[model samples]
Target: MQKTKLKALTKILGQTALIALITFVMSEITLRIYNKINPSFVFYDSSYNRFRGKPNAPDYDFKLNSQGFKDVEFTVEKPAETYRILGIGDSFTYGVVPYQYNYLTVLEEKLNKSGQKTEVINMGIPGMGPRDYLSILVNEGLKLNPDRVVLSFYIGNDFLDNYMTANLRTEEKSYMIALIKSMIKIQSNYKGKVLNPTTVQYNDNLPTFTDEKYLEDTINKSNMFVRNPADGMFKGFVDDAVKDLIKIKQICDSQNIPLTIVIIPDEVQVNSQLQKQVKQAFDPNNQNLLDFEISNRLLTEQLQQANIDYLDLLPDFKATAQKTPLYKPNDTHWNIAGNRLAAELITQHLTAKNQP
Candidate 1:
């Protein structure tokens, strides 16, 4: 009886192991194909303080270069008579739209179209902040010998992004496990909300963004805009962000590379209609509760003191926000129109300096 039972147990164990192996192989194959359509783009690396793109991740639309960034592979030896600008920032710089529609791409095309040979390298990574920008510049940016560095500072959550990165858990290294986790997380989050390149593929159509809960959450989450960066509820994040920005400037100056900080304004600060809604939901009675431009004013003040050459896009964006759709509905990042506007403005500014 004992011999018979032992043999039966061994047979069961072997069957289970075979089944598990088959399941793992099938799951890996499925994930690899899914990644082809919407790549599992960015990952948290032990080597860096922030999230970076998955190297050579090619989706249906765009491919991250060999360096794990949105732009093409960059060689340290820049071509002669070619001007290269290292574009830096978070998702806005990494881009939520198609690759060709990003401001960096548009800016490069516009500059080249006007007869000046220029290469605008997109060094932007999603979920990055001032500190991450500084890190990338130190690690890979300076080696490229860029002529200029234009760092795009989004007003929405850069300060918050900088602060929260310290607490985020690193993602799994295994592709199948990572993809499974990513899918589960995406489904758990609000519907129609695009989080990362891995979550959703870029499209020309806008998302269904009328989820009031998402709007309220976005307001409370990004409410740092309602006060001065120095004295507000988000003082710690603001201070940390500023210190990193100053360090970035110092590094660029040390290398004799001109750094231009492009301040991308938040939509709440610029949109009065949205402000009314925010006021009602967030502060029912106070008309003056939200101070939209205070963040821009305070941040720019620090930049001026540091003598950092900066471009405040608030005015231009405000002037154009209503007439043109700058931000995607309910989403903090810019849509296609917003990208085009920024490209146009930056191109005008850059070209204005060289024109006779």
Candidate 2:
């Protein structure tokens, strides 16, 4: 009886080992095959939550094809006598479609025409908010010793960006690799959807996030989407934001360089009249929108109290959004025209401040 029991136990252990080996082999094969088919992690989807599909998702540095600043690239650092402007923000700052008039490029051209001896570096990354910009300021930007650091703080998502998704672990290459891997998984599940969603043509030509529908959803969900634990005014995010602001202040003060914070308007805060249209389109029930008044008051009050110099662009952005759609239809990023407007506004402010 003892001999029979021992034999049974051995047989059970062998089967378990065999199963483990098969599982490992399958996972390896899947991972490899997946990488082969889907090169980019980004995919297209029509789901409201995921307007643009990102199944396997690229790393933070993955440059999408529609990026606005694709035509613009930075060269090696030049001498200090040459004025350099480092522009930082999320995708808006990094134009979605390649262009000559992307705000950064626009500013550079304008500054050059005036002979300001300036080079504007587009340091914008998609999905980054204040924290990511702050990180770039310290880690990557300061080394160049920019004459002026223009921080374009997008009111809509930067608040959330400050609290969450601040620090990312992967570098650009590893991120691209992971994105490729994710694409493979998506292809496995994909039926007939095109690889690029935004590439498709649409007639409405409405801006993706700025519409009334988006603002309503944003207002309702704002509370649910904090960038960090201290996203509220009196808490950690406020303190962190202040600290980040101060750090930039200190850098400028030390270098005797001017610092400007360009407060980029979120589509939600463009005002009730404009927001109503979006509400009508997406949620006639108006179930998802937030109270713009309360949010605007809180944000404005904080910056004012901090004594930070900011150019609130809501009034102007609202007018522009009303006249022409500033956002792309398939993606949550500003189109070239929107970028041009932003740059023009910033230049006007700067030129006004510098006037003799």
Give the runs in model 2 whose Cα sits over 4 Å from its true position. 1-76, 79-81, 166-221, 224-239, 271-274, 277-289, 293-296
Q: For model 1, what is the error of residue 283's alpha carbon versus the real structure, in angstroms, after optimal superposition?
A: 1.4
- Note the residue pairs that clash in candidate 1: 41-54
Per-residue alpha-carbon lDDT of candidate 2 for residues 1-356, written as tens digits (9 for 90 to 100): 99999999999999999998887667656655664454222322111111222333322233333323232445457655577888876667755554454688788888777767778887766666565666777776788777788888775666665554444334322434445655775565333333324444432354443334445555553452233224355344545665676676676677776777887765555544545554555457754543444544555676677666677776787787767776655344566667778878888887788720
Give one digit per residue, the lDDT tens place, for model 1 in 215-331. Answer: 676678656755444455576676788899999988998888888899998777677787777878777887676777877887898899989988899999898877877887767
Local distance difference test values of all predictions, in order: 0.78, 0.59
Against the true structure, what is every candidate's RMSD?
Answer: 6.1, 8.4
Q: Indicate the TM-score of model 2.
A: 0.64
- After the best TM-score superposition of candidate 1, give how far the Cα of residue 5 lies from its true spot, in angstroms: 25
Error of 1 at 324 (Å): 1.7
lDDT of 1 at 323: 82
